[model samples]
Target: MSAAFFSRDIVSLPPSSPGMRIGLFGGSFNPPHEGHRLVSRECLKRLDLDAVWWLVTPGNPLKDHSDLAPLDARVRAARALVAGPRCHITGFEAAHGFTYTFETLSHLQKTLPGRRFVWIMGADSLAGFHHWERWDEIFSMMPVAVYVRPGSTRKAAVSRAASRFRHGRIDESDARLLATLDPPAWVFLHGLMSTLSSSQLRSRK
Candidate 1:
């Protein structure tokens, strides 16, 4: 996808104020589904986040983009599905030409220094997180919250990234305080898993 696609439907990020706890949920979101909403809601409740940002990226460097959807279309779909005063959708990654997770996250921390931001992801993502660029630095930059995805808990829990950061893991009972904690902190939230995924939906189509 080209930056032009994002220019067509640049989404405004959710309102943020100093000291507010926010969750940054970045993904291609080629086709937003109920699972995405589930993660956002869980983060809002578990992390005590003031808002959740659904970053609709232009593409994922780790995945084949031969069949990826247009950025504008994906952003529109995300906006329609993730309806909530606290939920927001943005294609800023495309707008700014950020090809890696670290770049986008670094920008967020630099620009929104006053906000307490937590990186949110599902167990499925965590299972392959080590493959992500600057994966470890992500933990050092801000806190993380991983929600259980149906059938992915075991793999994620034993993944390399998890093993490396095991000492930084916090008990689920401390979830609400995750955003306020210092770097290298994370919590694994259990219950209410979702089996839905964009790839599954596309394959069915």
Candidate 2:
């Protein structure tokens, strides 16, 4: 499976409906698992999103490229795991030649200007978000919904971005309003946690 085969056919796909609230959950998906589904499902339930797009990246900039599985294999595995109408497994970002999460979100915002988009991420990613390229721009582009993974809540809350934008944290009750709110608004959702991780799964292979 190579990068060439994994890119998505974004142009041919129908445009998102007006007022559609979508969650963008981008990652390597080296091998998608229940955790991915749990997070997306929880976001859909709590954030009132119409769908969750699994933007499977060709590889993560922060991670070691050597360990990444081929993009096509990862896309197939992700499609197999997230088998649901509301959960879309796409290599759209890879197809568009966007490697970074921030860039992908920007592109999506422009491409689907009418639809509401919320950035979905795990607590651990939130904690290390500052390391991402143009991370602050992401906050300005759309609301971020952080799913609380076990052992990452406290540390993530104390992270630089959280502290810098302390005023952005919204109550769980207000989470569903995230898509409509201004950029920088975010919420930490406590949902069903899964211990599974791609790193651990890869190690076993």
Candidate 3:
């Protein structure tokens, strides 16, 4: 099935006022789990964001798609997990046919000007962020919040993206100020931890 099948969910953009701080949390979310929720809640509280937009993608270009779930199903699953007016789940990537985070983020900033956008991700994704298209540009376009994940702290810390942007890393104590900071600013958050992962959940199925 195509993303068009869920026409009602192909959101143009979530409601927001000027100066609203929104966290752009993008992922395949093959099976949205507590781990995903943890990152969302952490970023929301720590970054003092007004909302967290979960950009459920069509598929991850860096991973095999043979096991990827249908776009509509994944979006539905995400909606069921993330609630409240502040947390939004969107399949716009599938609807707009965007396969790159850089493009999707750029589109959001262009269409929704005057909003503070921060890119949110788990440490695991940070470890391989360099493989993404124009990954460096993504850092240049918005502030970033990386939550520590099980067994990925060290790897993510020494990651190419982390090392390259080391000078821009801010202290976690100033996390609440992250949304207000300029591009290239990032902070590594700790405390919340979950062993749950989409891959492990998929394996059991």
Give the TM-scores of the predictions, in the order they appear.
Answer: 0.95, 0.93, 0.96
Scored by lDDT, the top model is: 3
Better of 1 and 3 by lDDT: 3
CA lDDT of every candidate:
0.88, 0.84, 0.90
Clash totals in order: 0, 0, 0
Q: Please give the range of 10 consecutive residues that has the lowest summed lDDT in model 2.
A: 6-15
Error of 2 at 96 (Å): 2.1
User: What ranking of all candidate models by lDDT puts the best one first?
Assistant: 3, 1, 2
1-205, model 3: which lDDT tens digit per residue? 6656767755446788879999999999999999899889888898899999999888888899999998878888998988888899988887777889999999988988899999999899899999999999999999999999989999999999999999999999999999999879999999879999899999998
For model 3 the local lDDT of residue 204 reads 100
Residue ranges of candidate 2 with Cα displaced over 4 Å? 1-15
Ranking by TM-score: 3, 1, 2
Best by TM-score: 3
